[model samples]
Target: MCVSAALLLLAAVSRVTVAVTLPPHTYQTPYHAQVWSCREVLATLMEQELLGCSFTIISVHDDFSAALTPFLVALMITHSRPYQVVSVGGGDDVRPAWHSTSCDVYVIVAKRLLVLSDLLDTDDDSWDWQGRYLMFTSSSSANDLQRLAVTYKLQKTTDVLFFIRGTSDSELAVYTHKMYSKRSLKLLTLWRDGGFVKMVDLFPNKVNDLRGQQVRVLAVNHAPSVFSIIDHLGLLHNVSGLDVKVVQGLGRALNFTPVFHDPGADLWGSILPNGTATGMVGQVHTDDSEMGIGNVFLTEVRARYITFTVPFDFERACFITPAPRPLPTWMAVSFPFTLNVWILLVGSVLGLTVLVPVFGAGLMVRDYQELHSLSASFLLILAQFSNQSTRRPARTPMQVLVGFIMMCGFVVSVFYSSNLTAFMMVRAVEQPYTSIRQIVQSELQVGGYSDFWLAIFQGSANQDVRSLSQKFFRFDNVTKFLQSIISRQGVLLENTKHLEYLQKTFLTNRVGESSVRLMLEECINPFGVGVMLKRNSPLKSSADTMIQRMREAGLVDKFFKEVLQEARGPATQLSSNTDVGAEGINPLTLQHIQGVFLVLGGGMCAAMLVLVTEKAVAAGKYCL
Candidate 1:
């Protein structure tokens, strides 16, 4: 008894004592437990395991006829976390419940009891031996028990048998097994030396289906999904947002403990050109993990090899491009009006200039004192168009014609004043690449993480996609890529989750504007992302069932609100073409009106040539 107490103290010192929540049970000093029957010793061991062991398992033989079978099962039922039970059968045939349950620890009520020699000859594969906390109720000799311990690699020091020599008649009579044919023999937790003593049989592990199985989960290191952060101690931990929360929520509901394996994003998952899987997908196929959880999109190519659970998030493939650059300085003047408007304005002025003189040229407005040449006439017309007074004959007809020209001049001046005021204020330009087509046409390069996206763009038949592929620049460094985009040097294609993550975590240190200024609305296509696993894995079905439950319960929506807090600040940036900016509208300047000036110069040169030709004809009149 002293030795047992000392050993337990040493074990606790060597290992951290896990605080396992246990069923209500009485605890005794070592002396009392050690001196009791073998059943008491076994019960004490199970209680210790249930209290401190990482996993606790107990098994019951599924034979209703056995005298001590019910007592042992009732005793085993008082267990908690890390504890599980399984039923074993005799050589005749397995029961429906026993076969389905895959019992781990069996308190054998064998029809034809096997000797120790037969147990030693038992195939190792017959039982999935994890070497967990094991205790069984069987009637066997001590020598056979030792041999059984050696064969199954179990502790021989602990007694696994119910029978004990020199114990009272109370142990052998088995009053708990007494049944009445006339009436029901009810038992109320009818057992001795500490175990379950309930009348009705209870299968806790069976009722709760999963039994807290430890599932090997692969959490791929993708931000906003399952981001891996290295602490000061140099240990990696998942600090992902909603996705990790979702996985944790599923784990609790499914009764599975996740042992995360992070090989990082580069080695996450991918379908090679040869149509096989690599990275986490290969790990699952090879049985290293049960499933890979992250933003694993269920594409057709990957679906061929990977089994996906019901999708949790469906998001579009979008781009994170640079801020808008300034407009060209040379186009400032003509930029306010369209080409057709400029042409129409020039034609109107020319038609009016020619008509003024042709319709009323010699109607007494012609006096030698006043200017009468075509050059003078053209200058006077410009003066009227610019709202400046010009010398003219004091003729009623000419006065009336000039008055009509003044009205046209007032409208032109008002149009110019309104258009140029915007540029005079805040001279900013519109963003050049508004759409995917515009981006492809621009000189800037486009790219992002080369997962499957680069291939998608390259293989596309659309001319815009083809052009984007031709000029694509793969991002070697995420920080540099983000900075480059903000500087208006390149455009990036990425998932919304990743883009949002980068915008919050990394872009604060960027040179210019933040998330709102950087446009990310151009989506190629929306793809379904879900929990991924090896093809035909049972875990897939379980995860799918639970994920749907979460969606229906509104748990998924709640998680998104808590985790994806990407709405840092309001964005005043406009996306549509007609949407005006806070900066100002593009204003027209001298460069815009060059079309008007060019025609005026051309007309003056033509007038001078005509006058010279007429003078030459008059000089040769003497010869005629």
Candidate 2:
């Protein structure tokens, strides 16, 4: 009895059915069952159902989750509604994760069809139930008449077209009258209990909606947008960029197949001395390719050469630089002012020494003998400037003047002390080249792909732009740029959109965000992003219309947001602590102020040497 119950449990768990042909041979009976992936079967049923429709797919197969790639590729090609696929089953409730796709077709698979209908659809008695669905069994339909009845009870009163296998023509005729479709597929493939081969054609290719229209597209193997998408359907195609979504969107709108061309090293087309176009733009200009689309910036110069559709994005051209390292802890002593300011303060002290003694000594010379002597007068003046007193001079006009000199000394002492405290209490944020002038003045070199920035800078009227043209070094390729950017070897000029995306995806993973920053104020020629095309290409208008529809439908923003969300692969968020201290003031240690002490030590040594030399000279004079 336990063994019999175990067989029933196994059949229930695997969504299979079993039956015994004869009571004596029951133990030897085979369980012939058929299974289908809901995604493929449903997509086939509603071939054009997903066209212009946003969709969601739910799969119960945990092992073969990648089966959704074909449907995802279709969405990419059509630029239809943004969609997602999720796995459900294994004792987990898969209810709350269900969100509406809005104008959607929900493709769901479970052990039975009723579970999906309850999750997705509202009952409509008038809806057609003819050939929209299929449920096939192997050679077990005959002896397992009770199992067939159980399946019917689960899928009762539904409009989904059914394809059921029957034992023979006599039994099939009986099954046909049961379902709304009255349709029954014979057990031809299972003739003499044969293996499953050439079992089904998901898409028979009977419909020819496209009549063979073709388009040539310019592409670079950029990631998360247009690169290479491979699927089990033997489809290995490129345009692996989310930016190239427009091409597919337009292709579907205009009914054409896109043929992509690679521009090799040059992404933006350049003008050779021979006056020929080369690069992605070049292909579009010469009609070698119909349109170029893949995160390419639209510029006035390119517009002059060829043509560009109205922009779908606003982007800027800016330079990327490595973030500055932390300032030395010992340097905090002189942090308030430059070395030149220290020199000027010392000179002021000397000037006041001479002037105060000379001006005040004459009037006091008559009253005090200490003031009458030049050396004594000098000492008295020095005491006032030093904010000290050897003897209180007479309260006379000249002495008053000396007192005033002492007050100036107090001001200097307070100023120096205050500045030193401020320096010791705070940190120096090492932001090198925050603005354009700063970048031009810094030793850090500016660089970018020559073909991209040179044209804009060369033709610009702004003096700053023209001056910047003189400073750029040409970048040869992406490999060198990636290495140099993190190491502080070079500052690269690139579009802010692509640069930001690259950081969120690639560079941040390797070098980290602590080492780099994009300078926006230093940006030049902020432009709109658009598809490149020939000067008088007829497809431009249609492409522009499709792009405008995406904008109107808010898909462009949603597409990029989805790309960023999906590509978030263990990227760490940049820490604010890297820039600012925990308490806002990073306390200075001896290391932070070491340079200040070093300069003072050198000054003391020089003074001691000079004093010793003067004493030696005096002793020599005494011997003479």
Candidate 3:
């Protein structure tokens, strides 16, 4: 009887177990059964070409997203790329670090469509939506797909793919858009066909041609980079420069129209202390301008705000200051000989004056009475040195001494005359500051129109650059900065090419000589110059490709030379007399010989004073 009870209890337990397992087998949802297949479709999508090797999965805290995150991460790991899964409770809870970390592709899975939209539509620059994005949502309907398309279009997110899950897990709709266009979403294909997943090219060349669309460009009136000609009405008439030519070439190649806008007072913008950008950079940063062109340099700080194309040209930063003034004209008398030579000449004359009297006394020459007194000896020696003959001495020893003096005088006179003539013809100038170190050591205030130039060197590891940054000044008013340079009160820092252009165009005298001169030493090594575009601009790849082709074909350098030639016009010929010889020798003017007359007038005045003093003393003695 106990064995029979045990069998009945075992049968009851078996029936309960069968009832629990039968429901899962009979009412299983297609979604639960085909999750692995959905993963396979995702893996195929990820196999498409990407921008980099980093992968990111962004999802909200929901059952659908949480369940899918592991599968996406597994695929990324299997593909051997760096991967990160970011889980957020809501759109507003997204971390700031996620915005800065660059990823080649982002896989976003959300339970609700609103959550995905909220995450993408964050109204801040902290999150730069660069690279490819693929989105998946459990709320898949025709309207949901359309809403996703609109969201991407509104955000201008071009490199994106949308996966629309249908009622049956086997079917998924894939959609994307052509960049820089206002078209409806393009259907690449459904993910599954006849139980097999089909592969589609997620990212393609959509920006090859912009189809005559207007591209807004921010530009400044910086010469050789960009030149703007305005009419009397203050309207822009035309624009041309090396940078303009490049943009025009791009427009032609890519079939787009470039509409330029001036940043008004911003010019080439700078980053403020508050981390906001101004001018051309600000426009690009805020998406107000598609591109900024005016010899924009590629820097790490700037790269954070905007994207730069491949380098089209190179330039070195240089310091320009007023040209050194000519030395004082009154000092020309001493230009023929150095200080040591003048001292030696005076010493020789005095020595002859003393020795003549001493030698005459020692020789006991009866006919050498002129050399017996100091005054007589001095007059005789002075006459011989002046290349003038006086009464001859009858003594052989005195004649021999006079002949030697004449020979020495002739040699000295010839050298002095030649050097003096040269000095009179050419004006000597003061030594200029040739290097950054010299300018730093000088009292001249070093400055520029923009603080951007100063900021470039502020973080340098080089000691000299660090020292330069400490003394650097910034001027908001360009006119004032230029006036300071012209007035010789400050040194202006700028690019070498622009400085040269300024020297040729504006900073020149009426005679066509440059008023400002560039320092021999550069403030910084040559760096690359490129076009500035908003971060992750659609036109970057195409622009870079076209620029690379132009550089390789030597067209960039050709454009640079052509723009320079056009801006400079005819070469300036310094005014000169045709009577000058082939060696360019100039004749002496009154400006040169005034020093000699000054010395003569002073000597005559001294003589008159001495005569008056003698007469007065004689009168006083008579009275006494």
Candidate 4:
């Protein structure tokens, strides 16, 4: 008993008394700043009780690792209580090995540095073997180490994982199970001086999510929907080894808090006033005049169910129509040119005949010339109809003839002009119109407002058309009954082809056919289609991060280009003219204002002209 007590005392004394000291360090000039920066930030935050004291660093040594080694040791030693830091060494010729120790004031230095190259040594099972805090400065292998550490939950308490990679794969795997079973591991580049701000903007609430209660995030293949939501909430990777049943079990166990939503537009202030804009609100019965799809909603609520990203490419929508035919020249002139023009000419000629009696031979010759002129005028009128040359009138000819010819030509010109003009008034120029099918087959949905009458017409009547292909929905007025049907109704029609053809032709032939198709089909014109969210929602920021990163990385561009190529490959115009680019957000008033502006301008011009005329008349300029 006495010997055992002595041995126990010796062991306890050894455990409590010895202080590990790292050699006085001279850090590499370039990496010293980052090493020290990590040390200082950790010290400050941890001192404030913001971070746990259990942070650890498992170093892989290269030259750069030597500089970073001292800081890690110093960080471990500075904690108020006993702590641990492990140093591991490996090379191509040597198998990787580790040395671990606990110290009251730990300051053990490593001869090597952590690099990206070391990541290659990791095994699938080794991810959860270590602590959370890791710095890979010396080589390229560090990114993998970081991923493994993150994936397996080895480095659980570290908030910021920094890496200086000579060469590293972006697809680093981390064992998140050790570091944190529940919280997500966010890997971002941290520079030596003060670059955390960049990451802060990208991930503002990351720290908060990490600080939340510990959770078990399971990935299940059996029930993807259930597991996805659970894993997402728990911040767990879908690649985690957990089975589908486990994931579903976890989901079933969790009391998912329901997200509350308010009635309004999304963050961008675009949402159809009709409730269809919001999925949770479900579909609502709306009238044609109410806010249909295409109304802008704020950004907050949208982030709840899905992600929202900026529109990278602009789209255009235009109605192509043939130019109108020009009106006949004669119709454009004075009305008298048609009927009385020739009569006046003839009367003038006859009056001149009276002068012939008084003026003898000279007057008679002039009268005869006048008569000849009339004859020429009459012939010219007839020539126009027969496509013959028009003869000029003589100085003195038959006045009646000249007048008659002029009148006939004027009348003919009027007839031609009026008839053609009237026909043009009703002619509907056939232009190639594109509809939703073309867009759907293309799989490139764009945003726009909804049409109401068309929604009802198509929604209730068409049994064959598949509406899910369209991603955008513009909302207008719809009835509650119809909304219920759209929300809950499903039908399986055997004779779908006939019904579709008839419905389409009937709707397309109507005036405002495009609007009708959108309204009725519910597929054509989705006004408030797509997801919207509140401006300030954290979800928006999260989605924005992924979207922005994906965009900058050129992923979205590739996706759309691929989709467009596939869609246009076939000789089909499946999703043709769907985009009506950036429609203005005026529910009403644009048309009225346009008419008012035109009328006002014309009235103002007329008033100004009348004032000028009155002033000129008062000055006695014209006496006729």
Candidate 5:
């Protein structure tokens, strides 16, 4: 045991002398000077240009990130800027916090090329990173940078910078991506020649010139918004509408070629139960189309899945009901006066019939024997009211009473004659439904060809709107729906422009008379209508700019008017003899004067019944 201990002591002493003799082993520090250079460049850019901008650092903890993170934190502390650091262990380990944070700039630091690629491959669309500047620190080759830019579809609008660490500690290559050009990778190296660092623009403002790039657009054949003419082969020959014109104007101004595609089967898409969209919205969300434009309205639910441009137009949803029909001939006789006026006239006539007999008896001034009894007095007064000849009274008091009765009867007859003549000539119509409440109370069912019409109002705070939604129905066949409207079976809920289009195109007769008419009360006030695009689309800014300019120039309104006029064409022109009043006054027919004949027949029947009643009374008195 003692010999083993001495040997171990000798080996320890020899190892200590050998370790002391080894010439102070040293290795190069990874990215030592490059880290400092990056800190300096970032400090200058942030202080001078990116003031008040928050930053986010995403790192795969490594030797280089370990060295760079401390310097960045120190710089941020010195400038008193808010910054967050996210350490990624794997692709799935990326924290969702970084995605939701409101950071202006993002710096991704990783050692391996795979790590950087994996970090960028995350499919999170809720975060809007298109407007943010992205800086990548990796040792990947410049070619790899180009591949990443192309693969990730980083457009010129997105500022993507790469800081490539060279073999030596002092060597760092700064590059940016020019997405439209053939050589996408552009070098903007930081020159440090005369003991001072020449500041390089790390994030430069790039003009988003699409450079005649072909962008796919989703659209449908919605008239006035979009009218598509297709050939026999189902190939679209031409397209025209206010929305098409707007898109064409945008294409001209932005120097981009818009290739429109129809979102077949899914006309104007809707959100599904699974929180996914189908139709034009789905196409844009899936990156199959860059934008959608065909009278798409900006709604809160749709806005959650897509981005809408500044509204180029507005939509006023209205109800279209059947036109008021002409009043029946039976009603024309009574239409001259209201129910209350008719009641007052009857009451005054009866009251005078009773008073005339009493007055004749009390004053003892009766010259005619007909004024002695109630029945006889009624007949005499009725005859006077009918403006017929009546027996004259000799006494002054009786004459005065008769004159007053004549004056009242003459005034009422003159007013009734004038009113009846006007009513018969003008063809008065029935009262139409003027409000949504009235429509709800009516037997007419509210419906439209598109579900979107009623879907938008399902969540309304107004009780009337909610009740209307409950009564709403969606029709698949537009022809049937229009027929229902014409037959007064249903009331159509649609945009005002669309309702007008339908009236002019389908509901009008050869003489330009429409069977359907829009309600006076609007169901929904005017709200903005706009184009839809994918969330965080790069085309948003340029498209918005061009649309705003077109609006200012009044081109939008001009396009709308032109489309509507063309749609109307000469098919809906009013004929010269269309209006009855346009020619001479309309002559009365049997349909007009049938009510007067019926009144005469009723009077004859009443006279017969009175004669029978008097005979029965006399028979009973004789039997008694």
Candidate 6:
């Protein structure tokens, strides 16, 4: 009986299913939608296979809960009869700390997919799940998947597959689905499996002997976008007996294949005798990180090891900005007089003080002696007290002294009044005027119509800018509002700095210089500039290319001249911050140098005057 029971227990344990824990439920809508959608697609793709598997969607109902942490999730999943498992959402969640269970499959999603790909798994770890299956996924469905896959140490023949759906139908659909009217079903199948070889070798020099010979040798530069196609075709072309020659920049080649160790070392020289890499190059212009000017050499001479062609010397890049303009003279001057404001204030004070006293005395007037003399007394009082003229009135000496003192007090009062008015005007312009919060309380208008709307949504139409406004602030402008910010009194809630830059670009002393102005105490969220790449690719190399070619060709000088012209043109002016920054610095300085005409003319005149004096002195001495 004991032996029979043991056998049954073992059988039961073996039959137990594999289970997985899903992440928390508190993900933002878009994040939730992506995860759920991925799951939905995955379920549909492998629904039949997952039927008997016990899968649990483990997630926190709230973001603050410690219970939904990856450690706890792992503990829960492992408690059951673990079989195959997939881990998505990488970093600490799937570090080697987690003890490998009977389950073998693992999937990971990277936060910033392309950064630090070198640190990721680079060896063939697929066999760790030889009997089972493991898969990795990344949140960066754009511009990093290929490198991510390579870093994860996934082998070409390995069961692991990488997939990234495009954000638009026009994107991948262009090359994939719509490449051919009625595409070959077999070709489509090959492409779908990511099994098709897609690369081409172009030799501008040698054509015949290398035409069909398999070219295993390839040199890729920083352009990773060109790699996927290059790598795929490289394999096929080599197998087909064609000498495949891939001449490329540095960054792209490193990402495509991980065969070379220590990427930073060098590939431009004959360093790699092992033939893993043919051409190596050092990054050019170490000062400029953005400019793609890798200093490497390449040659076509075939060898058992890597080879390089003579460095493809290209032209240097040129950067430009709007030229400088002569600033308004008054702008540089401190508030002059502000005299009108002071005058208005003084007049108001004097009128109020004099009228109050006259009205009070008029009420006391009674008989003929008082009435007749009162008119004369009033006139005498005015003349003596105001001190308008030196002409003395027929009044007592005491009255003259008292009147003079009163006139001094009145003059001081007027001055005080003027100063008070000037202060008020300055204060009014300094107070809080417009912001996202203030916009809710008041009506506002915006310029750059489309961009203002698009920037808020991350370019998604489902959630409009108004909806975002309502979410952040309760008020809503349901009606389509026109650009009403043109009027001086109207308010504009905007990213002030951006508008400031745009103002210089589009409305500089041109037709619309006064079109828009920033109100006091108004600022929005600060935004930074970003460089975008094609979805599922690395940073585009052209930014680097532009820097290198220009530096080599000395076109950078010509570029500076052009940029200065633009920066100083009448239609546009460069903002102090934007044009003075590194990219635009050269152009801004060039404009100033070109506009030194006044100084040059003044120096010439001084020299001519000295020469004329010397000549006059010589003539006088000779005549004497």
What do the candidate models score in CA lDDT, each in turn? Answer: 0.53, 0.54, 0.71, 0.34, 0.71, 0.31
**TM-score, ranked from best to worst:** 5, 3, 1, 2, 6, 4
User: What is the alpha-carbon lDDT for the whole of candidate 4?
Assistant: 0.34
TM, every model: 0.53, 0.50, 0.68, 0.26, 0.76, 0.27
Residue 372, model 6: Cα distance from true site in angstroms: 8.2
**Cα distance off (Å), candidate 2, residue 178:** 41
Each model's backbone clash number: 10, 18, 0, 119, 0, 55
- Give the per-residue lDDT digits (tens) of candidate 3, residues 1-624: 001110012112322321111222343444442345456666665564553446667766777766666666656555555566666673244442443344466777776756555555565554455667777776666566566665533335657777767546656777775454445367787765433355655666556666776777877777788888755543344888888899999999988878777776767788888999888888888888788888888888888888999989888888888788888888798888889999998999999899888888777646657778888988887777667888988899988988899899878877888898888877778887787777777777778656776777777776776677777887776566767776778887778778777677566544456667888565675679999988867778889999999999999889978877796654333212124456766667777888988999998998999999999999999999
Candidate 1 runs further than 4 Å off: 1-214, 230-235, 252-259, 273-276, 328-335, 362-409, 435-444, 458-463, 466-474, 486-489, 503-522, 536-542, 545-624
After the best TM-score superposition of candidate 5, give how far the Cα of residue 149 lies from its true spot, in angstroms.
2.2
| Poorly placed runs, candidate 2 (over 4 Å) | 1-217, 221-266, 271-276, 285-290, 300-306, 322-331, 338-344, 364-415, 425-446, 457-476, 485-489, 500-523, 534-587
lDDT (Cα, tens digit) per residue for candidate 5, span 1-624: 001110001112222321111111222356656666566667666877677777776666678777677667656656666666666664344333443333367766666545555545556452445545555464678777777666444653467777776555555667777644455677776424212244665655443455676767777777668888655543344788888889888887877777777887678888888999888888877777788988787888788888999999877888888888777878788988899999998898889889988888887545677777888878777877778778887778888999988888888888889999998887788888788888878788888656776666676776777788777888777678777777778998877777777777667766567778888575765668788887877667877887898899999989988887888764443211255555557778998889998898999999999999999999999999
Ranking of models by lDDT: 3, 5, 2, 1, 4, 6
Q: Check candidate 3 and list the clashing pairs.
A: none
Query: Model 6: per-residue lDDT, tens digit, 411-522?
Result: 7545544654453233112234333444445444333222233234344343323443442321133111112332322332333332443355443544333334444343
- Strongest candidate by TM-score: 5
Off by over 4 Å in 6: 1-387, 390-443, 447-484, 487-494, 510-513, 527-624
RMSD of 5: 10.0
lDDT of 2: 0.54
Q: By lDDT, is 1 or 2 better?
A: 2
Predicted structure 3: clash tally:
0
